[model samples]
Target: MPDSFGRYPNMNISEYLDFFARAYGLRGASRREAVERVPDFTELGDLVNKPIDTLSKGMSQRLCPGRTLIHDPDVLILDEPAAGLDPRARVELRELIRLLASKLQKPGPDQLTHSHRAG
Candidate 1:
């Protein structure tokens, strides 16, 4: 699912990220929120709108992991998600991944808490 990034191959930064999320079943709203959280993401957002070939090596490197996460796969296999990101971006991305894992690990509050506590 390449979305605008892979599909149109000439989309703007915003369109790329937005479409990438949609292709992977993520809501456009959530994708925008997540991008906002990343440092200097506005620049990246702008880059996404441009031609993919216009991106520098580092920028292109950073975008790969972001697209991977937009889908929220059950088993994410990141070869090098942190490769070109700044330290802050890497840390932020790590926290996001941790949060996502936490979400997936926990059961519904009622079913999980009640069953565990009752026992």
Candidate 2:
């Protein structure tokens, strides 16, 4: 799996978002609409031109959600979404997940389901 920084470490945030948005078949107004969603949902506005490698873990984590939602999928399945996040980032991710769930019309219990494997 690609690390949080993604494959294009040299690409700035706007370029990265635009590339993925376009790759997902978004164009014209749809592309603009998808690109517009990033800033609305994450704290990435100021970091738009910053390279992905320069982003902090929290900021990098925020990007993943935006990328996943660019196509506006009906369901989102995340595995260990909070795995490497710091406390604040984890909270932000949780809230974002909730917002996504609501927007995707998939409301349910607040808790996420996970399988704990005993080592």
Candidate 3:
């Protein structure tokens, strides 16, 4: 996997989001909607046209989680995702991450839950 900084490039923030969404399994308009909710993500999309090093540290951190979600990995491992975020941004980001976890599932009855109940 590419480092977080290596992910965002000279593309629209939407385009990169679309790219990563496809990399996972989410399709069509749903993934697009999820990405748009990110705070200041629109401006960040514009900023994506510039080199990443030019971004503020908070912006860079916010972008990294989006990049990880792009792939829709079966398991997501985040380290200090809210470290530098302000209270509001951290809360928003936390909600977004929760949504991502829910979406990443294969949409069944949650076999893990069923198995434990059965046992």
Candidate 4:
């Protein structure tokens, strides 16, 4: 995950995603499970197997969040995720962010919702 999606001509989207997931310490069952959720989470659909270099800006944009989220960080912040997208894509991205924030409240460990105080 560069500041922008790099042109990995030899790698497909799945490979690209897996690379980041592995770097984030998600391995074995957890890595596979997390990677499996990316397509749905990013609305990547059938594009998962497509080569990275062939993706358009919109499709490439989807990779950003998917890559960062493979480990389910306690907090997520986006720096203009919709910056280069069209109006429709921007709207869709907004809805996606909202869905990610609101719909991901599944039961888990007993850690405080905010464990570390944000400075």
- The TM-scores, one per candidate, come to 0.48, 0.77, 0.47, 0.77
lDDT tens digits, residues 88-114, model 2? 767778788667545542343244323
lDDT of 4 at 119: 15
TM-score of 2: 0.77
> Candidate 3, overall lDDT?
0.54
- The predicted structure with the larger TM-score, 1 or 4, is 4
Tens digits of lDDT, candidate 1, 21-115 = 67766665676665443313323644544665677555665555555555455555544444455677656655644544444323312211111
Give me the runs in candidate 1 sitting further than 4 Å from their true place. Answer: 1-8, 35-48, 79-119
CA lDDT scores, all candidates in order = 0.49, 0.69, 0.54, 0.69
Cα displacement (angstroms), candidate 1, residue 35, comes to: 4.7
TM-score of 4: 0.77
Q: How far is candidate 2 from the true structure (C-alpha RMSD, Å)?
A: 4.3
Better-scoring candidate (TM-score), 3 or 4: 4
Badly placed stretches (over 4 Å) of model 3 are: 1-43, 99-119
- Listed per candidate, the RMSD to the true structure in angstroms reads 10.5, 4.3, 8.4, 6.3
Q: What is the lDDT of candidate 2?
A: 0.69
What are the per-residue Cα lDDT tens digits for candidate 4 across 21-61?
A: 89889899988877778878888868889998888888787
lDDT of 4: 0.69
lDDT of 3 by residue, 1-119 (tens): 22235545466555666666776776767776655644243236556445555666666666666667554455555555666567776666666556654654353122111111111
